[model samples]
Target: MSSYLLPAIAGLLTGAGLIVAIGPQNVFVLRQGVARRHTGAIVAVCAISDVVLIVAGVAGLGAIVAAHPQVITVAKLLGGLYVLVLGLLAAKRCLRSNEAIAANAEEAESAGRWVAVGTALALTWLNPHVYLDTVLTMGAIANGHGNGKWAFAIGACVASILWFTALGGGARRLSHLFASPRAWKILDAVVAVIMIGMAVALFASI
Candidate 1:
C-alpha cells in the first residue's frame, strides 16, 4: 500500500501539471463554462478522453510511440497546423467588437449540442501534445512504477476528472465578471496567445 501511495501521488501531481497547461481543449471548456452551455457534457468528454489516453499510455503505447519517431513528427506537423488555425480564429474573435459572453442559456444554445461535442472531440484528439503527454510521457512515467502502474494510472485519471470538473463548473460562478464584451475580448486575446505559443512550441520541438 505504501508503495502504491507514492506512485499515486506522483501520478496525480504529474497529471495535474500536464492538464493544467492552457491549451485548445481547456480554452473551449472555459468558453462553454462562461456561456453556461452544455458544460456538463463538455466536461465529461474532456475527462473521459484523458482517461482513455492515460490508460493507453500506461498499457505500453509509450513503447510503440518511442519505437516509431515518425509518428510524433507527423502528429507534430498536423497538430501544430491545427493549433495555428485555432489561434488565428481566436485572434479574429478578439478583434470583433461583438465578442461577448452569453448571459443566458438561450443565447448559448445558438450553437448546436452536436457541434459543441464535435469541437470538444476535435480539440482533445487532434492535438499532438495530448498524445505526447498522455500516451508517451504519462505512459513512460506510469511504467516506471513497475507493479504499481495501474495505481498510478488511476491517480492520473482522477486528476483529469477533478480538474475538468473544477474548470467547467467553476467558470460558471465567474460569469458575472465576463458580463462585459471587453472582458470576453481580453479572454480571447489570452487564449490566442496560449494557442499560438503552443503551436510555435510544438513546431519548434520538431
Candidate 2:
C-alpha cells in the first residue's frame, strides 16, 4: 500500500502540473463558470475526457499515439483554427456597447445546452497537447511504476477531476467581479488575447 501510495502521489502531482496551465479549455471552463451557465456539463466533459485519456495512456495506447505524427499535425491545424475563431468571437464581444453586451450574455444563457457540451468536447479532444501530455507524457510516467501503474493512473484521474471541479465551482465566486458590462468586456478581452496567443503557438509548433 505504501509503495502504491507514493506512485499515486507522484501521478497526482504530475497530472496537476500538466493540467493547471492556462489553455483554451481552461479559458472556456472559466468563462462558463463565471457566467454560471452549463458549468456542471462543462466540468463533467473536461474531467471525464481527461480520465479517458489518462486511462488510455496507462493502457499502452500512448505508444501508438506517439508514433502517429500525422495525427498530431491534423489536430494542431484544426485546434488552432478552432481556437482562433473563438478568440475572434471574444474580441468581437469586447467591441459591443454595454447594452449589447448584456443582451449577448442573455443570449448565451439561452443558447442550446448541447452547444456548450460540444464546445467542451471539441476543446478537450481536438488539442494535440492533450494527447502529448496525458497520453505520451503521463503514460510513460505511469508505466515507469510497473505494477503500480494503475494506481498512478487513478491518482492522475483524481487530480484531473478535482482541478476542474474546483476551477468551475470556485469561478462563480468571481460573479460579483463580473457583475458589470465593463467587467465582462474586460474578461472577454483577456480571454481573446489568451486564446489567440494559444492558437498562434499551436500553429507555430507545426
Candidate 3:
C-alpha cells in the first residue's frame, strides 16, 4: 500500500498537468459551462472517456497501438479533418455572434442535447493528441510502476473527474464577464485559432 503512494501521486500530478492545458475540448467545456448548457453531461462524457482510455493504456493497448503505424496514420488524417471542420464552424459562429451570452435554463434546455453530446464525443475521440497523451505517454509511465500500475491509473482517472468537474461547474462564476456578445466572439475566435493550430500540427506530425 505504501509503495503505491508515490505512483498514485505521480499519476495524479501527470494527469492534471496534461489535461489543464488549453485545447478544443476544454474550450468547448468552458463555453458550455458559461452558457450553463448541458454542463453535467459534458463533464461526465469527458471523465468517462478518460477513464476508458486510461484503462486501455494500462491494460497494454498502448503497446499494440504503437506497433501499428497505419492505425495512427488513419487516426491522424481523420482527426485532423474533424478538427479543421470544427475550427471552421467556430469561426463561423464568431461571425454570427448574437447569442454568445449566457442562456437561461429554459433556453439551455431547449437546445438540442444530442448536438452537444455529439460534439463532445467528436472533440474527444477525434483528437489524436488525446491518444498520445493518455495512451502512449501515460501508459509508458504506468508500466514503469510494474504492479503499481493500477494504482496509478486510478489516480489518473480521479484527476480527470476532478478537473472536468471543477472546470465545468466553476465556469459559471465568470458568466458576467462573458455576458457580452463581443466577449463570446473573441472567445470563439481564440478557440478557432487553437483548434486550427492543433489540426495543422496533427497533419504536420503525420
RMSD of each: 2.4, 0.8, 2.4
Instruction: Give Cα distance to truth, residue 32, candidate 1, Å.
Output: 1.6
Candidate 1 residues 1-206, lDDT tens each?
89999889989999999999978899989988987888999999999999999999999888888899888888888778888888898798788755244343346568788888888888888788888898899999999899999989999999999999999999988888986778878987988998898889989999
lDDT of every model, 2 decimals? 0.87, 0.94, 0.86
Give a tens-digit lDDT track for model 2, residues 63-157: 99878888999999999999999999999999999988777777787988899999999999998999999999999999999999999999999
Q: Candidates sorted by TM-score, descending order?
A: 2, 3, 1
lDDT of 3 by residue, 13-41 (tens): 98998889988899889988887888899
Clashes of 1: 0
RMSD score of candidate 1 (Å): 2.4
State which candidate, 1 or 3, has the greater TM-score: 3
TM-score of each candidate structure, all chains considered together: 0.90, 0.98, 0.91
Model 1 whole-model lDDT (C-alpha atoms): 0.87
